[model samples]
Target: MTTYKRMVLASRPKGVVSPQNFRLEEVQAPALKDGEVLIRNHYLSLDPYMRMRMEDVKSYAAPQAIGETMIGGTVGEVVESKNPKYAVGDKVQGMLGWSEMGVSDGVMLRKLDTTHVPLSAYLGSVGMPGMTAWYGLTQIMQPKEGETIVVSAASGAVGSVVGQLAKLRGCRAVGIAGGKEKCDYVVNELGFDACVDYKAGNLVDDLARATPNGIDAVFENVGGTIFDECVARMNPFGRIALCGLIAGYDGEPMALNNVRNILTMRLTMRGFIVSEHMDLWPQGLKELGTLVATGKLKFRESVAQGLESAPEAFIGMLKGKNFGKQLVKLV
Candidate 1:
């Protein structure tokens, strides 16, 4: 095909993201250069971090400019190649954005081994989310046996793995999710010790009951009230791995009322971007891939059918409408 479809940022979101913020358009696919590979993207990953990129405000990464293809992770099969490093029919992963097709010079793409893990998994459990969980739990939280470990957004792609890893390490895994279904999934499906539903309107009390021993380590995903409640229950010298703050991603500035807990409890909270620590990826992916390949690690996905569904699917994810990893199947 000479042309392909792509979703671009039509406008920066003011509060909550909506369909109007994205514009899907067809564009001419340029001919491959001497070192380029043409990939027909099969899946596109929708993540919370993409919300932060929608704003013009300063962040670790540049804001997605209006008219630029919406940034994302993708897994696809190379359909044509001019580069020796990659060949046609090689499945690969890259930051290819929300497009049906993308061209790469082999700098960003990495060939995948779909024999062990499914291709879609490269966008979820055995991919960035898994790496995030591993890095945060191992490099930062470092929970010891019998310690109470709490994770917010417990049913999400990252939080699910965090709690599972915590459980494997002999720590008591307590999850905090939005609803009863998600909480139940975290506890039963993912083997978390307990899961508290924040939307039940008894968050503080529910969390207290779940982490009766007091939180010793926390894998924080949703910030704002959920984070504040978790911090209020932290044990002295507890470690917190701050991954994402999806609760306040729309436009609201996050204000933690329990900031005093940090001082009183002497918490060690560290915020990290998974990509920054590339040194740990090989180790993290190896362990995660093994767990997944062996059936020790479990993950779920909520997929949208086509590329045109990306904007709506993304908005749903931001509102906690998706159960696990949200993905768009393009081909």
Candidate 2:
């Protein structure tokens, strides 16, 4: 039997991820059965959620076991198929690991048409990331016209979409990012009303000046220091959509000091996962798709070359090194 190369978790990570924590291994892929297809991975999305999976802790999602293939979503091409629903040369989105190729049951794989958009779109704005923003805004945060919205990690895969959606709905959008360059991108290119540089050392004061009336809705991505400030500044009856906490997911818990704000403001906070709200995905996708197709939506991706660079790309993403969606191109 012929085998393919894959990146697997060698051991659980402690603080920050290093290349030594992961290993490349060759594993034999079994023959496809009925309702199964062989896929050639084209692109792999590296998200902040993956970092949480690297640790040994209880979370909403299950932790990836040591010595198993690292869990991630992928956009790939079907090279062979035993499933009647799928044919050769079809593009798909599936729960495939970081590998050259693999056979999977079509249950988790959704057929994709690259003709309408780029093949990588399934791993980006036209797919999960887009759906995440849609659900977080419409279902979770519930922003009203003239309300102010604040989002952390504002230049990232999920946060960027959150900011633009707020702007589209006639609300003032404020973004919090790591540096001046990223802050500029969200404000100038993505049309955010204001942005704060978290590294500039004035997150709390900047947020104060940017949102004078107080934040009505917050799309939270970095859930440590930024969250503490956001909770402190929330308006009465404010809505907060808690997404991934990249800063805290890396193992350093930020000290919090906002008990008075939560109690006095009476904020309603909710945490959501994109997959849990899959029932509304069709509607969300259709809406976001129209925006992308009409050019009202814009996306940026930092793509790594091949499977050999997956580890480095994964590491860089935890440190917020890439711009927009971080992807690994296998072919």
Query: Which candidate's TM-score is highest?
Result: 1
Q: What lDDT tens digits, residue by residue, belong to model 2 across residues 52-98?
A: 88887888878898888888889888988999989999989998987
After superposition on all CA atoms, what RMSD does each candidate show versus the true structure? 0.8, 1.3
For each candidate, give its TM-score against the true structure.
Answer: 0.99, 0.96
For candidate 1, lDDT tens digit of each residue in 1-331?
5899999999998899989999999999998889999999999999999999999988999999899999999999999999999989999999999999999999988899999899999999899999999999999999999999999888999999999998899999998888889998998899999999998999989899998999999998889988998999999999999998988888788988988989999989999999999999999999999999999999999999999999999999988899999999999
Whole-model Cα lDDT of every candidate shown, in order: 0.93, 0.87
Best by lDDT: 1
lDDT of 1 at 197: 93
Can you tell me which runs of candidate 1 are displaced by over 4 Å? none
Model 1 residue 94 CA deviation (Å) reads: 0.5
